[model samples]
Target: MFSGAQLSLYPMSDDFVGIITGALSALDPHRDHLRIETDDLSTLIVGPPEILFSAMRDLFVAAARSGTHCVLSATVSRGCPGEPDDPICTPAEGTLPVAPLDERIAKAVAAVKAAPETGQPVACQVSLYPLGVNQHMDEIEGCIAFLKASGVFDRPKNFCTKLSGDAGAVFATLQQAFTRFGAAASHVALDVTVSAHSPTRA
Candidate 1:
């Protein structure tokens, strides 16, 4: 399966360049495990879901630690037929096909519960797209059910669902929702925006 994410970081500060550059170092440990490329627009990370989410979490946390409001926008996808499979995207261990919706929802909830806290709190909105599947709505609904039970779920938004909590559980929830839905080899994508240290938060 081919899995990857294209993400951009925005730090609301005059020294945004410094903050972004310094925060990128958080991904250093994951460099060997992922194929990372950065241009003017966004950074593309290709690898297994575990390394992908962890790297994202670390990078976002590093930037947020600077005490500046930061937002991370990411489009994560897996099993897209348009993209060719790369050896680097292979997981260390193979995965089975997606299970029944109820089973998947249960497992996703369990995974989020087990996520370690990062102390850094984040608010995020996400919309999942399960493409090329006949029962896409079923998968989407199942994901929504899982999110509502994820403990981090904040509420439902206009076109997405809102989640707020420690960055750890939030990201874990996103990862689970992305992986547990749709067919194993089918295309699945997640549109996500995560904010930390926002001024408007009470």
Candidate 2:
């Protein structure tokens, strides 16, 4: 019942890093840059000896291996005050949303930047998020090749082979590339997300 408590842990050792990392990774993909502020998000885990024992033991073993002995505790902002709430952990190193491989990739995405209401092109930068970075290289190459061959774009060597049309075209092309690249590797947790120009009221 740790609803309004902050969950915090004292680092026991490098071994605990895995336990923390694993827990966070298993929970939220956006777990990173935790702090003792309102913005910080963590899972409050508190309970009897058996509840927090196993994970804590893992942390302890990790600390032992790491040659460090630190205490760790995290409280939740909303939950039962007496019992441990679900672990709300954010990873220390989460995946970056931008997966731009090279200058050419950036150029390719920029080339298809979204236009504004004035029907005029606005300068924009595109960021790619490559998931499952270590996967089938050949498949990745194939997707890029297909995009390049299909895009029919030249002159700007930096330009990507993204479908040259509107913002949607570029997005669609990127997805298509991922689908093609993920061949056979069903767990290919890799892909890129291009944030279109942010929408703001005039």
Candidate 3:
């Protein structure tokens, strides 16, 4: 099984260059664990699900810490047939090593916690796809219920759900969704887009 994500970062500030570079730099340490490619549009990262999520957590945190408004949009998938047949696309025999979901979630929560509070909450739109699963709709509905009950979910939209709150809460809610549904399901994909310092700074 192979997992990957294509992500784009948009820092809503005059000093966008620094914010973007800083986030990319944060991913440098994980280069050994993932195959990373950055083009004009977005950055592609391919690796085990755990590593992929970890890298995303770190990258988003670094960008949010900039204190400037920003958005990180991503599409995550696993077992994609369209990808090139490379080592990154093929996992060795036996189960691929994956970090504990709790560990990964904690890291993300920490990053959000450390971000400078702009007194303005952030929002994120998340869409989950449960691939090759029996009763996928049931799972999706369950996850949506969880998000809504969490008080972070803004509303339910077709093909996706919206979340708005402080950065930490927003990220924590997202991690829960991934772990509860994405990780538990036999195969799952996620599309997540997050905006910080939302509603625009007047």
By lDDT, the best candidate is 1
Q: What TM-score goes with each of the models?
A: 0.97, 0.27, 0.70
Off by over 4 Å in 3: 83-121, 149-152, 165-169, 172-176, 179-187, 200-202
lDDT of 1 at 77: 95
**If ranked by lDDT, best first, what sequence of candidates would result?**
1, 3, 2
Candidate 1 wrongly placed segments (more than 4 Å): none
Q: Pick out the ten consecutive residues of candidate 3 with the lowest summed lDDT.
A: 89-98
- Identify the leading candidate in terms of TM-score: 1
lDDT of 3 by residue, 11-42 (tens): 88888888888678878887898988889999
lDDT (CA) per prediction: 0.92, 0.32, 0.69
Give one digit per residue, the lDDT tens place, for model 2 in 41-142. 544333321223223233323332333444333321222234343343211122212333443344434433431122211111221223344655644554
Candidate 2 Cα outliers beyond 4 Å, as residue runs: 1-135, 152-165, 191-202
Ranking by TM-score: 1, 3, 2
Give the better candidate number (1 or 3) by TM-score: 1
